[model samples]
Target: MQRRGFLKLGVGAAVVIGVAGAGVALIKPGLVDGKLGPGARDVMRAAAQAVLYDLLPPPGAARDAALALQLDRLDAFIASLPAPTRKELSDALGLLATAAGRFALVGLSRPWAEATVYEVHEALNAMRVSTSNTRQQIYHALRDLNVVAFFNSPDNWRSVGYPGPVQIP
Candidate 1:
């Protein structure tokens, strides 16, 4: 083939492959639902519980309610991200939910839901201070998401001494 024709063919092939890959990513179950899958959701919940231990209410109705609210907010946050970002977070959460990933990422061999609060804290600290920028980013992302979701709620504002925004009559 002529050089110009060969270059055009290569570019066309690249575009086809990129479109196909994007289509596959868009069809992933989590993306379709606009939220993490059950296992990933569980992992996120555990991470939030651990990171927000001091801030969250004691285990009971209040805590459950707060967690549910936070999870909803977290889901919405994830959904609002760009497609590539949402996919990256979904992949990360899926990895964290597995025993192997837990061991590798957090130095724990158990599932995230079964990890003790101290263990979770250790894992998060490890990620936060990890030399890998990816690990640190993951730690900060989850921590920030949980804090923002929890504090954004009016019910929790009292705990933070944040009165509702003043209304200008």
Candidate 2:
């Protein structure tokens, strides 16, 4: 097939996504019953490795614990959002949790759990520079959410030299 224009690209992508979604629906990944699930957690864990590369502890048990705390904070933060926002985010996360979405939307050929930080970083960079606004939004959302969640961990406070909130009372 010859190189096509943006409109054709969008249409083709939509078609591919439609077919992929049909298959993904059968496996039931990510959110279920309006709550974040294991699939979403996997997606965020891999993404956090990339987005918080500098802040994260060097790879070890410490890093794993930190990532786990980050996921906890992320769930809490997302849970606090309005219902509609939660639904939208859940849908987005669900899509990214799928193999097709990971490859098509994120350009990551490997499973999220198997993807190295470098691969995840490169995939995120691709999304950041993409012409599609939706892709850009996903990039920003993942990065921002990771930042918010990781920094929220009190254990991580020392990484940025935050000494906790000053008491006013």
Clash count list over all predictions = 0, 0
Those runs of model 2 whose alpha carbons end farther than 4 Å from true positions after fitting are 1-13, 19-29, 165-169
State the lDDT at 20 in candidate 1: 52
lDDT of 2 at 24: 71
What is candidate 2's lDDT per residue for 64-87, written digit by digit as tens? Answer: 998888887888888777987876
Weakest ten-residue segment in model 1 by summed lDDT: 23-32
Assess each prediction's global lDDT (C-alpha) against the native.
0.74, 0.83
Mind giving the per-residue lDDT tens digits that candidate 1 earns over 1-169? 8999999998998677546544543443333366878767777788889888988889899888877878898887777779888777766665565554556556776777778778888889999899978678878877887887777678778877889899999
Which ranges in model 1 have alpha carbons more than 4 Å from their true place? 1-32, 167-169
Best model number under TM-score = 2
Q: How accurate is candidate 1 locally (lDDT)?
A: 0.74
lDDT of 2: 0.83
